[model samples]
Target: MPAADALPIPVGAIVALFLAAFPIFWCAILWLIAGMGWRRLANAYPANSDPPDSADRIRFATLALGASVRSANYSGSINAWLAPSGLWLRPILPFRPFHAMVFIPWAHVRSVASERRMLMKLVRVALGGDVPDLVLSGRLAQAVLDRTKAKKR
Candidate 1:
């Protein structure tokens, strides 16, 4: 008969390993965010406060920001709010490290165009100035466009 020996991991070692990995993980996330142009978006449309209570919220939305080549895809991780003033977007907690909530005013949204991609429909929103375009599903895009139109009236 043979018995197997069990090895216990030291609590301090586990803690130390986590401490060392945390910063690196955070840095990598920051790099990814920056690469996806979230930093640029933040610079242009930083949301200092939360979305208004009256704003209509869409959870688990899909959105793409920046150029298609280097876009940041927040598939099912986006919380989008449609207000009379603008469109508010923020990522879920885990993906929110360097991504500040952004509010792109209707005035800043230059254009909204709908296109069919294969079987799915998509909307491309062009913003003013140096801000990159925002691509979202057709439904969300329609909501945003509706808000903008309402604001104009």
Candidate 2:
């Protein structure tokens, strides 16, 4: 009895498969972002214009979305800007698809509270209306609160 030879996959076939799957993957990401409440937030506070030059930029920040305890955690992929007018948030380039940049004004921030979770100090900022609260690191949250207080004065 003779053994049959194995056929290798062509490089063109692999590239074609990836090309075909790209759009489907992108759509799935859009759906996931919507599920994470990003779509709702974007509708409420879309960033039509660019953030000001004076805004303080914070990279590799963490964020929590949704109202439930089992919310979506975007760890170390968020780029936040603390401007006098409001807080600007957007995901990094790779995760930016279907996630629009949003600007939540200081007035919308109802309250800011700090809490210790495990070893990390977390700050939760409650916003008005139906949007989810934003959870950030303690230091960053303090900066946001300070900015709001300064704006008031």
Best by TM-score: 2
Candidate 1 residue-wise lDDT, 43-108, digit = tens: 999997888999999988988885476788778888889877788888887777778889888778
- Per-model C-alpha RMSD: 3.6, 2.8
Each candidate's TM vs. the true structure?
Answer: 0.79, 0.82
> Model 2, range 1-153, lDDT digits (tens) per residue?
444664377688989999999989987976786667777788899998878999999887888885376677778888888886888999888778888999888878888777787898778888868788888774566677677667768
> How accurate locally is residue 16 in candidate 1, as Cα lDDT from 0 to 100?
98
Candidate 2 segments whose C-alpha is farther than 4 A from its true place: 1-5, 8-11, 67-70, 145-153
CA shift at 97, candidate 2, in angstroms?
A: 1.6
